[model samples]
Target chain A: MNEALTLLSFGEHGWGDTIAIGALVTVSLALASLPFGLALGFLLALAKKSAEPSLKLAANIYTTIFRGLPELLTLFLVYFGVQIGFQKALKLIGIETYFEVNSFVAGMFALSFVFSSYASEAFLSAFRGIPQGQFEGGQALGLSRKQTMTFIILPQLVRLALPALGNLWLILLKETALVSTIGLADLMREAGIAARVTKEAFLFFGVACLIYLILAIISSTGLARLERWSKRGDTAR
Target chain B: MTVVSSDTALPPPPPLPRRWTKARILGHVLMALWIVSGASLLFYLVTNINSPFVQKYWPDYVDGFLVTLQIVSVSLLIGALLSLPIAAARASRWKVLSAPAYAYVYFFRGTPLLAQTFLVYYGAGGFRTELEAIGLWTFFREAWYCVIFTFSLNTSAYQAEILRGAILNVPKGQWEGAAALGLSQPVTFFKVILPQALMVALRPYGNEIILMIKGSAIASIVTVFDLMGETRRAYSRTYDFQAYIWAAVIYLMMVETLRRVWDRLEMRLTRHLKR
Candidate 1:
């Protein structure tokens, strides 16, 4: 027990620092991708709902391809295939520098792409749930398209989208663990290293699992509160 | 705007011609370009199907597919069986029976399956002495057993939650109806509640199975020669990007086919509920 404690101690000889940094990396990776994903998802939803058949088709194909693929395969394709393609393109353009995608960037890009595909579906359904009369009402009040979107549609869309988005966030958090496979020094990777160095796989992995559970529990509670807060206006109605 | 005005205007102006805006024209052009590029890429891959590298590595992918199927099937079967008792425990009114069940589900669901896999696979090595004493060391030492164990445990938690939810979804009137019919508790539950709960749980169970199929790809990272593992190996050998593409296509086909079959099954099972 003392040996295990020492192994986990926050000292130069211990892995506490590495594991902490790994956890931070995992959180940051998820955070960095969230906005990109949500924005793209919003765009995709709009494209899907647009009157233009071409735009709708494009959005359908995009979501289908991304959603159909596994997350790890997507990561690998982006990391390896894109890197190779990009380097070749650069070479053709007479750029000699070797450009490679770091694991974090690859993970962020792949995960965001996957997240957007799923989130687009959520956003589309939420958009569909809005009454047509609400849009007509906005128009009757002389609201510009932008104003109607921002002031009228978005607020309600958000309330509808929040629960699904929260669930997506949870999935995203867990997915950060997959980044470890691509050699990212995230919490899972750090635990792996600690396990290898100390031959204490049980201890380190157990610690990692506990950390993930803590994050999940905290986030779940926060999400529950957010859901309640979002519905407060509804309760009054 | 024009349509509204036309209702008040003379003769409705021939229903106004369909006008394509600049954005619409641009969208059409871009969509055409996208389809052309996608088709060309597919054509390139098809033409290269007979390439020597692909010919050599194709069998590896097939083997990997078989291994993946085997692992997923066995683990799912074991997981479904294991989930029933856990679900029963979770649904129990007694705290003593439910608390540990709740903890199991919570811990398993909260953490990533990768962590659980590592804890089982690598962690078992750390307890070789204790395992050997209990004659379980040989099982832990093998990656196959470890993967099966971890996958089963991880999936059982999700399955138990689905089952418990289904059990609760069986209406209270069901219990009353059973009691009024002079049925014992066990007979009522097995005959009435279980069937209804199972019906309600079918869609979620299908979703869980789909998730497990995707989740099983992680087993490749642990050196199991699953489809993803073969894809990785093929990529390393030939530096061909199509290897990953092939694996992705296979996975896509599996998921899509499973979803369709599940939907059909759900429709058939719940047909009685529909008017």
Candidate 2:
């Protein structure tokens, strides 16, 4: 009991600070990927809406491939895969340097890429949910297609896309833990390390879960507020 | 814009009008990231072909992939079997039986899979002495057993919801008709309700099976030599990160195959509904 308490303590020797930083890094990674993922998702939604066979097929294959694979598998692919590219480029430049791909970058790239595939499906449905008549109205106003898409089509799509996007983000946040497999000292990894050293897996894991739950609660609240804000624009219609 | 407007007036775009426009070319260029990422992974493994890393660990990755496939297939089979009874209980009229089943589904679904996996695995470890006293430690001690136990329980909750939703989607008239024929409650469920519900449920179950294939990789943490486990081992021994890339390639191929099967199944199931 004493040993467990000391291990969990916030002293210089204790891992409390390290674990806290890990939690911070996890949050930062999720936030950084959010906008990029949204953009990727929007493109995917557009591609899915394509009338052409090959374009539609391409979008279908993209979502199907990413959605079917495991998050950790994707992470491993991105982690080492990027390293291979860097090494090849270095060789081409006649530099023998071994370029290290850091864990933070790897985690960010992998999570965002995977999150976009799911988000694309969400956004595509949201786009489909809008009545065809609204677009007709946009055209009736003499607005160009691009203007109609930007001003009329997208804002409403965002509103419709919010709930599913929120759920995807929640799943994405929890999945950041997989980054630890590549030696990233994220919240789960830190907790695992502490658990290993002390052999008190329960205590550290409990703390890790508590942190994740708190993160989930906070993000859900923020999303609720955003949803409310998006709804305000619906009143203009 | 003119083409789009004309096409809109005609109801649906023309069959094939040079699908790859410049905008689409740009879109494809951007999405080249995924293909590039996948290609980079392949390059990593191939370049490291003659490295000691590949020589020592290539067999391990193959063995690990087999184990992962085995674990995922078994868990999906068992989990789907178990979920039927639980779904029935939840959908049943008895509050005593239904409430507990509902709570179990809710709790498991609400939490992340990783936490639940650890809770079951480590929690079992914590209670080993007590379990031994009760003569259950033998079963709990094996890594494979623990992995199966955790995965089966985890998937059962998700599958219960899928089944319950499908079952409820069955028309109430089926029950009335069954009763008009003097069928028993069990007979109505098994014969009438289940068959219809299964058509709805099977597609989602396929989705769940694909998900389980992914989730089984988590078992690597518990010393189970799944594909991910082998990758981790190779990286640790050789410090050649490409080993992990090979594992990921294998996983991607397996998942892509499952996705094709799922798409076909969904297409067949919904064919009658389509125009």
TM-score of chain B of each: 0.89, 0.83
- Give the docking tier of candidate 1: medium
Per-residue lDDT for A57-137 in model 2, tens only?
677777876786688777877877788779988899898888879988888888888889999999889988999998999
Q: What TM-scores result for chain A when each predicted structure is judged separately against the true chain A?
A: 0.95, 0.91
Please report how far candidate 1 places residue B120 from its true position, in Å. 0.8
Where does model 1 exceed 4 Å of error?
Answer: A94-97, B1-18, B21-30
Off by over 4 Å in 2: A1-20, A52-54, A217-237, B1-21, B27-59, B89-103, B235-242, B266-275
- Single out the weakest 10-residue window by summed lDDT for candidate 1 chain B: B1-10
Model 2 residue A115 lDDT? Answer: 89
lDDT of 1 by residue, A1-237 (tens): 999888998988889999999999988999999999999999989888988788888888888778777788889989988788888899999997777889999999999999999899999999999999989999999999889999999999998999999989988999889999989999999999999999999999999999999898889999999989887889987
State each model's CA lDDT, in order: 0.91, 0.82
Residue pairs in steric clash, candidate 2? none
